[model samples]
Target chain A: MIPAAFEYTRARSLADALKAAGTRGTKVIAGGQSLVPLLRFRLAQPSVVVDIGHLPQLQGIKRAKQGTVIGAATTYRDLLDSKLLHNTHPIIAETTAGIGDRQVRNRGTIGGGLAHADPASDMPAVVLALDAVLTLQSRRGKRSVPARKFFKGPFATAMKKDELLTEILLPFLPQGAGTAYESFEQAASGYALVGVAAVVAVSGGAVTHAAVGITGLADTPFFAASAAKLIGRTPNKEILRAAAAAAVEGVSANEDIHASAEYRLHLARVAVRKALTTAAGRAG
Target chain B: MTQTITLNVNGQALKAQAEPRTLLVHMLRDELNLTGTQVGCDTSQCGACTVLLDGRAVKSCSVLAVQAEGHKITTIEGLARDGTLHPVQQAFWEKHGLQCGFCTPGFVMTTVELLRDNPDPTEDEIRHALEGNVCRCTGYQNIVAAVRSAASALRGSRRPGAAVSGG
Candidate 1:
C-alpha cells in the first residue's frame, strides 16, 4: 500500500523549518524512521512533509559546561558511535544498542523517537532516568521542558503543533555514578515489553542517589519517583527488592496482547531490580 | 505534487518523477527497475528493503524518495564488479546462507554495512547485528556462519570498492 500524496520541502535552515512548520498540516521529517512507517499505514496524513534531516542546526553532539547537548536529529547509530557519550554516558549506548536492529538505528533520530513517544521506546526511559531536558523551538523562540514533563501519553507529547524538538540536554553524572538500562524486548518487533533505566550514585558503599525510569508497563515512560526515595539507603538485596517493588506503585500497567496488566507489573519489578543492581554494582 | 528527483543509485545518477510520499523502495523497484531490494514486509520491521544511503544501511521502505535526494545509495545490485561477487555475497553463496532467497538481498546489503564498520565480528556480534533482518527458511545458523565467513574473507581480501556502474 502507498501513503497518501503529500508535498515535500527540505528546510535549509532552522528559520526555514520553522516557517514551513507553521502550516497546520505540515509534518516534520527528521530521520523518518517512525514517521514514514506511520505514513505507510496512513496513521499519519499530513498535507506537507517538511524535511529537516539535512539541517545543520539539528546535528552533532557537544559537551557544555552545564551538560551534554545532543542535537535532535542525531541518529541512534550516531549516539552508539559517540566517544563522548560512551565515556560520559555509556548507558545511552547500552540502551540504544538494544533498540531496533542496525537498520532502524541507522535512521531513527533521538529527537524523532522521543517526539513520536512510542510507549515502548528506549530513549524516553533512558533520557528520563538521566534527568535530561528537552529544548523545543518554534518561530517565536525556544523553550526547555524537562524530559519527565515532555511525554503526555503513548505516541503523544507536549510539543505544540508548530514546534520542533531541537536538543536534549543531559547533565553529567557525578563522579563514580553508574547508569544502566534493562529491557525485555518483544521477540519479533523489538519493542520493550517491560524495561527500566537506572542511574545510581553510591558513596561510602551506600546509595547516595538513584534515578529510575520505567517503560512498557504504562501509557507513558515515567521517572519512578517512589524508587528515587532509595537515596541515602544501603542498596542491599532486600532493600533493592523493596525499591523495585515500589517502582511500579503508581503506574497503571498497560494490558495488551503482549502481556496482561498483572504480568507486565511482574516484569516491571524484575526489570527494575536488575537495572538497579547492575547500576549499583557499577557505582562507587 | 509529482516532481522530478535525481537519485544516485548504484553509482548512476538517474531522475524520476514521483509524489512526495513515494517511498524509496518503490522508486527503486518500480521506477528504476532495481528490484533486488525486496519488500517482504511493507512495515520497517523486516529489513528486506535495506540499502546503503550515503554508506549507512537503512530500511528504504521508511525513507521517502524526496528525502534521499543527493545521497549515494547502494542496493544489492551494486555489490558486484567485473564478474566477481563481493566477498559478503560470495560467502553467502559458499555457506549456503539463504533459502527461498526473498530476504537475501537485505541480508547482503546489511552485512555490507556491518563488515564495513567492524570487519572482524564474533558470532554473537553477527547474530546481534542481524536483529533487523529475518530469514524464515533458514534457522539463521547458516546465515550467521555466512556473515562470519564474509567477515574473514573481507578482512583477508581487498575490500570491494562501492563502485557504481550502469546496470
Candidate 2:
C-alpha cells in the first residue's frame, strides 16, 4: 500500500512551511497519522507534501490570560503528559487519552485531527463543547474561526487549501463549571459510535450555564440546542431525561454496519444524559 | 523521485535513498535489511510494525521513512547486547508468551516501552497497553504473564542504590 509519488519538502521554519503550502496541489503533513492513511488509500493525491511536524513554532501548550493555547502540531502524547492541561482542562486530556492506542497517540496531532474533520473523531466534539477558537494562518495573514463553525461535513472543514491551522485557543471554563465526555466506541477502530460532551455550570442549586456537543450521529459534529433547556432550572433526573430525548429531535442520524440509525439515535440520547449527569455532578 | 536521507537505526547512522511514500517499516526492512520488524495488517491496525522512535513506540508503517531521518529508531534487532537476550525477550521465552511467534517482535517492543514507563503494571494495565498489538494465536494469557515477569526482572535489574517502591 504505497502512496503515489510526490515531492516532499521538510519546512525549515514557519515561513518556509507557509511558502511551500501556498503552491497548488500542496498538502501540509503534520504527525501524518491521518494523511498517510489517506495517501495510501489513494483518497488524497497531492503533488507536493510539506512536512511541518517538526516545526518548533507549532509545538507547545501555553497558558494565556483567556485560556490555554495549544500549538497545532502538538501530539496527543504531549497533551496526556501535560500537568497544566490536567489541572485546567482535564476533559481534553481524558478525551485525547482514548483517541487511539498508545502508538497512535504518539503521532496524532490535534490540528490534523480537527482539520481532517472526521465526524467520528473525538476532539471535534470536545473542542466544540469547550468553545475552542481555531486560528488559521496563511501567507496573507491569520484569522480565527470558532469551533462551532469549523466543521462543514464529514472529512471537511472551513480551512482553505493554503491556510494552516496554527493554534487552538480553548477558553477557560467559567467558575463552578465542570465538563465530561462520554462515548460508545466501535470495538475495532475505537472510533465513537455516538460520542457526547457536556459542560455544565451550577449556581445556587440550579443550572446556570450548559453546553452539549455531539458526534458520530451525523455528517458533522454539532451542539445540541436542547441543552439550553437545562439552564435556569434544577437538573433533576426527570429533567435530564427529557432534555436527552430531544437531543436528536430534528437531526437525521448517520447509519452504517456498526449501528443502525435508530440505534445510533438511542445511543446519542443515552450518551447525552450520562455526560450531562457526570458534568453536573462535578460542577463546583 | 528518491531522496537520500540518513536514519539512526539501532544506534547506527545509515544513509539510504527512499521515495516520499516509503514507509518506515519498508525502509528498515527492505533498505536496511533489518527484518526483525514485521509488517502485519499494513493498515496500521496491527502493531506488528511497532518500533521505538526516540524511545517511544510508534507504528512504523504509518510513519514515512523521510520523517524518521533525524530521529533515533530502536527496532527489535537493537534489543540484545553481547548475544544476551534482553530481559523482556528472556521473559517472553521463559513464559511461553508466543505460539506462532509472528507477533512477538511487536509485542516485545511494546512491552519494552510499557515496562520502561511503568516498571510494575497490573494485569489490566498490561492488557490495556497491549490493545494495539493483536495476537491471532490467542496467546494473550502467556503474553500477560511474560509482561509481568519482565516487569519484575527489570525492576530487580535497576541500580542497587535505587529506591525500590513497588513490585
Candidate 3:
C-alpha cells in the first residue's frame, strides 16, 4: 500500500527538524520503519513528512561524563554495536535485540520506538528502569523529561507535536548493579506482549534497591512501585513471585489478534519473575 | 519534489530520481530493473526483501530509498564472480536448499550477514541466526545443511572479493 502523498522535508539538523515539525500537519519521521507502516495502514496521515535521516545532530553513541547519550535517530543496528552502551547498560542491548527481524533492527530507531509510545515497545520500560532522560525540543524551547513522565499512555506520549525527541540520556550503570530484560514477544508484529526490565543493586549479597519497570502490560510504561517496594526488601523466590503478581494487580494490557489481555498479564508475571532472577544473579 | 539518490548495485552506480518515501525495493526493481531483490513483505516481517546496505543485510522494504543514498548496497545478483556461483549458492544447489526459490534471496542475504558476523558458527548458532529468515520448503533441514557447507567452503577460500561470515 502506498503512503498518502505528502510534502517531504529532510532536516540536516535537530533545530531544523523541530522547526519543520512546528508547521501544521507535519510529522517528524526517523527510521521510517514504524511510522511508515502506520501511514500505510492509514493510521496516521500527516500532510508533510519531516525526514531526520540527514539530521547530523541526531546521530551517534558516545560515552560521556553524565552517561551514554544516544541520539534519538540512531538506528537499532548502531545500538547493538555500541561497545560503551554494552558495557554500561546491557538491558538496552538485550531489549533492542528482541525487536523484530534484522531488517527491522537495521532500520528501526530506539528513539522512534519510544516516542511512538507503543506500550508494547521494549525500550521504554528498560529506559525508565535505567533512569534515562529524554530531551525534547520545539520552537518554544527544550525540556528534559524523565522516562517515567515521557510515556503517558498506550500509543500516547507527553511530547508536543512540534517537539523533537533529540537525545536519550542513559546514566552510567553503577558497579554492583544488575540489569536484565525479559519479554514474551508477539510473533506477528514482533513487539512485546509483556516486557519487564529489572535493575537490582546489591550490597553485601543482599537487596539494596530495585527498580522494576513493566511495559506492554499497562497503559503506560511504569515502575511497578508496589511490587518494587516489596521485592526490594528481599530477593527470595516467594517474594519474587508475589511481586510479579502485584506488578499486574491493575495492569490493563492491550489485546489484539495475537494474544488476549489475560494471557499478556500471565506473561508479564512470568517475565517479571524471570527478569528479577536474572538481574539478581548478574548483580555485582 | 523528487530527490536523486545514488546506489551501488551489482557494481554499477545507478542514480534514480525517486520520491522521498520510495522503498529501496522499488529503486532496484523499477529504476535499476534488477528484479533480484524481491519484496515479499513490505512491513519488514518477511525477509524476502533483504539486501546488503554498507555490508550489512537489511530489509529493503522497511527503509526509504533516500536512506540508502551514498551507501554501498549489494543485491543478490552480485553474489557470483566471473560467472561462477558464490559458495552459499553452490552449497544451496548441492544441498538442495530451495523448494520454490522465493525465499532464497533473503536467505542468501542473511547468510552473507551471518558469515560477516561469525565466520565459524556452531550448528545451533547457525539455527539461531537463520531462524529469522524463514523457509517453507525442506523444513529448513536442507537449508541448514546448505549453510553449514557454505561456511566451510568459504572459510578456506580467500577469493579476492569473498569474505567468510554468517550462519
Count of residue pairs whose backbone atoms collide, per candidate = 1, 0, 5
Candidate 1: tens digits of C-alpha lDDT, residues A198-269? 999999987888999988889999899887688889989999999999988867999989999999999999
- Candidate 1: regions farther than 4 A off: B159-167
Clashing pairs in 1: B11-B164
Q: Which regions of candidate 3 fall more than 4 Å away from where they truly are?
A: B159-167
Worst 10 residues of 1 chain A by lDDT: A16-25
TM-scores of the candidates, chain A only: 0.98, 0.98, 0.94
Model 3's CAPRI class is medium
Rank the models by DockQ, top first.
1, 2, 3
Point to the candidate with the largest DockQ.
1
How high is the lDDT of residue A162 in model 1? 81
Q: What is the lDDT of residue B115 in candidate 2?
A: 92
For model 3, what is the error of residue B35's alpha carbon versus the real structure, in angstroms, after optimal superposition? 1.0
lDDT of 3 by residue, B1-167 (tens): 67898777767787888887677888878888879888776566778888888788877876667777778888888888777888888888899988998999888888878877787888887876665576777788888889888888877775667764322
| lDDT per model vs. reference | 0.89, 0.90, 0.81
True-vs-predicted CA distance for residue B155, candidate 1, Å: 1.1
lDDT of 2 by residue, A27-139 (tens): 88999999998888878899989899999999999999999999999999899989889888999987987898888888989998999899999999898888899999999
- Error in Å for residue A224 of model 1: 0.8
